[model samples]
Target: MLSTPNKQFSIEVTSDSTTVAPPLLSTTTKKLFIPPWKVPETKAPMVFPTCPPSCNKEMSRFNLDGSLKDLGSYGFWVEMCGKLFLFGRRFVNWEQNVEECCKIGMTPIDLELATDVKCINSLIGDDDYRNRFSRYYWTFGLRKTEEVVSSYYWCSSGANITRNWGSGGEPNYVKNASENCVRMEFGRATNMLYLLDSNCGLVSGLSCQGPIIPKTCDSPVCPVYTCRKRDALFKTLADKATKVLIDPSKSGIWVTNDTRLFMISYPSDTKTFVESLAACCAVGLKLLSLHQEVMYSILVGAFNNASIRGEKFWTAATDQGCKKNFGFCSTNRLVRDNARWASEQPDLSTSNGTCLAVSSDGLLHDELCNTKMRYVCEGRAQIPSLLDAVERECAAEFKLTRSEVKALFNSTPDELREKCFLKCYGEGTGLFIDGNLAMDSIFAAFQRITFDDTKRLLDMYSAMDYCTNSSKGMDECDKCGSLLNCGQENSPEEFEEFVETVQLTITESPLILPPVKGVCPEYECIKKPDQVKLLATAKNFTRFIGQAVVLPFVLQLTVVCNKKFYVFATNVERTLSRNLAFCCDRGYRMATIDTKEKYDCMVQNRITTFLNLPPGTTFAVGATRLGKLDRPSWCYSDTEFDFNLAEDFVSNDTLETNYGIAISFEPPLIMKAYETSLHVVCEK
Candidate 1:
């Protein structure tokens, strides 16, 4: 829905263009307040205590496989005396350095490490890294207030500072000025370090400490793979972007390592035809189609690997409200002749309706439109139109030239005009809100546009966080420019990958069918006085059943062969003796499956009702095993014993208890049990 910006536009001007009038007001604005140190007159110089002798102890460097491992995205990491110290290359203000450490999942060098001059010297005092470590380096130490000169404490641990003060009683607490942050300055002549109280806004190199964990190629914190901290902001975005993001391990979705994404909802979360469409739409996906055997096989394989057996998931294939031949709901493409089907499937009988469901065996089955069943959803990687629209709109509003816009991909503009342009772009894309970096919004937006290209999105997301953290303390306009610059300098591959993906045109797929007008199913529940009363009674009975049953928590009610059935299973486990009393409380008795027709109906519904139930879940029935395990007798004085029901249980003696007949949903069987607690199926 977004349009390209025009190359040129006309602006209204005065008819007599010979002379141009100057504006009445000055375009530049004056600063409301300025730091005392920045003033031309009365500027006080920074003071530091005398350099202390370096610690003479030999400090050993931490290593993995006889070599120091790369630990972070930026700054050189040195492991000494079982700790990781980061010598930052870029010089930034104190606050920016602190934010940088946090972005890399580290903290500013705390008091314990700062006091160890030997460890610090081992990292930056040597020739290999001396030039990169700037003159002043920031630490976690801070003075809480100027009123008390000794109020200094380590910001990371809140421990009081008793020693490690620079010579000359350094914390002078300069009058009429604030200097709360602490920094260590290198002495050029002595080749030693001196502690100084510096303004928080002063630029300095970063010195940070990380967790003592060893960094290896396979470790999450190892820079060799990808350096990123999965902070709270990332977790929040993941929760909100379930549809567009694929976290294969726990998201109930899978990818073919190419582009297509597939997912399924099962059992308790089943939906009807119209409800399924709405559910998929809510999550930015569409109902999946199994038009090819390979596609169907992949889903079946994933389900099998997940231990999902004997389940059916709805697909987009249907013949309703269209031509008589079965076709996909959206594309209207006829179902291929080779499409896998169950034996005697697509029975075009009016009773079966027209929709189709794919079973776990990779076969399709014709089902009714209103039948509730688990359904599959699908998505693919493609740039979202909403993001494209936002980019074009922001560029046009800021009036960025085509060349300037193109340059933004590989380099950040240094001019004021380009800085403001980046600010507009950041706000429009939700990377920044109210002039502050919003990592959560940025991640969500990226997931929405990239459609869960995990490899690219994660890399870019990490680079963006590093850039934003590195730009802390800058004015909003400059902050955007600095962030863009940092991104280009640090992670060029991510930017190139992003550009390549964004340039690809999205292939549109028809996701919804035309309105199914005037072809509603013939069955409809009409409101009538007596029928309404019956419905209310049924609702109360359903609620009562939940309270009367035992373990397995059965709450389903079905009617078969003119008999009303109630499955009673509460959250508790109860023995057969207790379940009998519970059934009587509801004015019903344990179910009797005497006839073969009733038995068949129960088995059919059992597959649907017990699809998600736990194994070893048993329900008490109306039969009793009076004989040995070889032969069993029925209940009600042992008058009727259906050999068919007991055929499979004759060889299993563990199920033979003093109680009576019970059915297990997992194995779909009838067995004898007494002492064992079980759920109940009552029929009146």
Candidate 2:
């Protein structure tokens, strides 16, 4: 076994110092002049010091020799003081096995020389002590070579010996043969040891060399000062970093420290599933799979920087290019409000301008490529929020007011109101009235009013008329007849006689009735003015009267009348005059006669017969008669009467007397009596 060496020293004798020992010469019986002390030969083997007791325990536990008793079933072993000790039964590769030993406070053995191998072999004993000896096995120490050499060297044993042959033989690292890994082998040539290459990941035994140490792996490595230093460095580095720098042009796998996160920015705004995956690979970040924790870690890493612009970012998870795997994709973090899954087998022929993001909350969110954001990257999936986690967000996005809530009961329509409502509120909200939405308070109030009230209001300002009395029954007279029925008492014979005398005299000789000249002005009567006429005649003790009244009622009202008088011989004319005066007082105008031309000729002839005009006298009868006829006169004088009588005789030869001549000459007396009675009756 290798052992520690002792210190050695040497002594040299020189010529006797000047006269030194003279005092001691007496005993010179062959005592050579030598130094009082001589150096001794120290023989010690080249060995490291004995390891600490803790290290010795760890080394013993990981020993690989069969004599070493196993402590557990994991195939772990240790070596301490050149003795082998075992811990577990399971075999692991050299690197992994070494790591396991280290976890238990032991380190893999460094068998770089033959002495190390000999020392270990001696402690475990030789074949002489056992029924059969096990073949040498490969140790953790390995060699890397590009080609196979004629002689394979054992890094652990530090020799080219065949005693440690693998199951088949020693490895040949000859020229032109590349050897990149090392493996382990066990058993002898007869039994055949197992040989495994490093790259092949074959399982094998492991050994450790050190003091047997019992250490719990939970010991803290980073002191508080070291932690502060690391945190400061992280902050300083992060502050200066403007963007995550990844070289998409390079190709290789990469890993992130726990302090740093990995992210990938796609080269283009949009891409196919295949293209996106390729982009990720170019940046050394594999698209995530369905490992929840890893995915969550990746997302958290992405959002570590608070200065990220977009609230959400994307991840590479779409399986659009995958044929067999469907529904393998990332979900939107804001999906409760804006959730939508891509159409199955989205049309790749068209540009799908969508992008995926891994948000700071450790959730995946998708957005259009034009939207900018920060994102996270991971090797796998993560657990999403629980069902109730996003409820508030969803409610905020979809909440409705009372009016909108009521709309849930109505049917959709085709008009603008309905269309607008649908556009704003989506498909099925109920608030329609007659195909129009009662969306406003005013419109709702209007809809609630009764139809009758609406109609009345529409016609409120119209106007109409009402009748008090119809003109249908009002009396109307056709004409103004003679007003001759005034007297209540008159003999029928007298009345008859009066009427006959007036009619006969006026009809036969209107001129003899004495024309009432200027009764109305000629100019006034010429236009056939509407007139009323009155006739009065008297016989003894009786008077007759007839009157016609003309009433002209138009926009203005007027009345016209004519009155005439006729008398019997004594006092009758006077009685008639009284009646005429009464009629005149009742608004009557007298009728005029025009007989000047004919009557003037007759007057000249009568004058010639009665009395010749004096020799020089110019008898202008036409002038005189015209003058007399034009003047207003109630009665004719004697001369005017005689002339008028003679004129009448010459014109018609019928008027032979001015009055009833000598016939009934004695009637004057009776006539006078009748006239008196007539005057009295007329006066009454």
Candidate 3:
């Protein structure tokens, strides 16, 4: 396999038998770069309407028609290379230029026009005119707040402005002067465009940009391809062997009877977690989710079969919220019973972030989300004939002729065509009900097209449903795309979830039409070592430092309190300080009992049996009358505990008492001295 020098992508070899080689001789670099500024002739200026009373700028600011409200109200409003732009004649502050553009129903020039500085500059015939208008101009790049430090966004599109800043290292905010707005300036020395963060109050010429005019078909009549024509075309294409199909076994990819196709990636072509997620989605799959032990074992066996062991492979288990609660991204539910953490794991240290990866031992370990790692992909293997039949029928219904539809699939689809195709497929597959995704129908469709195991189909439907539901209010086409996006892409949090640009792999792999019978490799489950529960003393506890932010821990507890679990380290003896340290060592917060409901629950239940403690023994809890308060408050985590339920306490308070207690078979919470030894209860 050959990868780019930057490792952004690699050539995918379908079969292990195939080999790829670099060119025997290096080719000459092509120097056919065309400068946008080299235009044949300058376009005529726009004619504007008369200026209104509200306008206070000079007469020259208005167009030749003597009006600022007209089309060319700014400088020279012209369409260049199919995009609309306005070059202003007068100097105006960033805010004023924004208002002026809004007055004309446009936004400040965006990155596209800003990059082609010479094109706009060349439009001016005279050097003086170019220096006056195109030399420097305000753009839509604006940083609204100082809190964000140094990121500017297009005010109109909200896209991050990431052009080559050139040598000046501009977005420096000019020695912290609060230069929160961006303007484009031409470097006379380099003849290149530079995006500089400038003060909003600075005056500069206006440069506004408008949307591109879409290409229109000249013929108004669109010839419809009826079902008869579609079938005939399909027969022709089938006879010619035009459609490329995937056969898993021949391609060295694994498929299981459980309705999941597992695509194993190798170390040579590793990608960051987010990029891996997108890579899988690009081909209609998701990062493998190990939520089920049986699935995990089967995948591990596949790893052994592929000779891809002894390395870390990224899984869908991640705390996408950045919270410590790790869950499978495919399902937003917490990873509780199935979480197999390595020793001292999920420490949330800078090195070990909130993302998860499975080692060769089949145990989950925390890894940075940005770290490059091999990943496994999981999805239902498609039957090529079924997919082709559906695609042909939809293309006919949408009037996307047989050739056009085939070409669209062969290449990367444009926005309009892709959306139209998605709409056709969504409806054709019965996945949509009244223009909305009907999640239940997904299972029915899966059962009809793929394997017919009820349990496996249900699991597949559940994952797809979660992803689709999260994108409910999006456009129909976007929703369809999002269903394919699944994991990190459709997560609730706003994140840099996708790669900056998607590179389309154009070369087609060899095709095999026949269905590959999937076989799961036999795997024997090995018993793993039990986690050692260690006792924490005041001296030894300080060795473990807390995370930068103390996120709520995910607890695995045996006792349930009001549907929430409270874990007790029964193996470790407890002292007021030792108990607190023990919970901290385990990344848990000591149990807090400030609410009346908690007090009542403990009072009603047999506390000794529930906690596996001796009867009449007093256990330590996370409560204290901090700083001369009349009643103690629960203050283990950053969360504030309610003290209004002080009246519900057993009227137990004393000057010597500094710690809270839960007595076995006792109803109300009582206080104990700092040195007091008692059983401890901890919560996440």
- Best lDDT among the predictions, by candidate number: 1
At residue 391, what lDDT does model 3 achieve?
A: 57
Better of 1 and 2 by lDDT: 1
Estimate, for each residue in 1-684, the C-alpha lDDT of model 3 and write its tens digit: 332233332233232222233122121322111211111234321121111112122333345553443442234556675557777644456756655554443456767435356565455433323222334567767674566465667654456767656455646654744677777765433445677876665545567665442322211111121111112212111112222233333322554432235776755768877776665554445677765433555566667766665788888776653456566664323455545778888766552336788886677888888889888776543222223444554564456877887565434344654655755564434344334443322322333222223333333333444455455424655565455444233321211111100001001121222323211111111111111122122121122222223232222233345533344424334444455555544434456665567756655654334333444445566654322234344433223345443333423454333433343334334434333443566554
Which residue runs does candidate 3 get wrong by more than 4 Å?
1-259, 331-333, 350-353, 381-684
How far in Å is the alpha carbon of 370 misplaced in model 3?
1.0
Model 2 agreement with the true structure over 626-647: per-residue lDDT tens digits? 1123232322111222324222
Candidate 3 positional error at 256, Å = 4.1
Tens digit of lDDT per residue, candidate 1, span 33-139? 12211312343323322111111111122253433334443455667767677776444566666655554445666554454676666544553444334456788
lDDT at 632, model 2: 22
lDDT of 2: 0.28
Please identify model 2 stretches exceeding 4 Å from their true place.
Answer: 1-88, 115-138, 148-163, 166-170, 174-179, 188-200, 212-684
- Residue 111 lDDT, candidate 1, scale 0-100: 54
- Cα lDDT computed for each candidate against the true fold: 0.51, 0.28, 0.46
Q: Estimate each model's TM-score.
A: 0.23, 0.18, 0.23
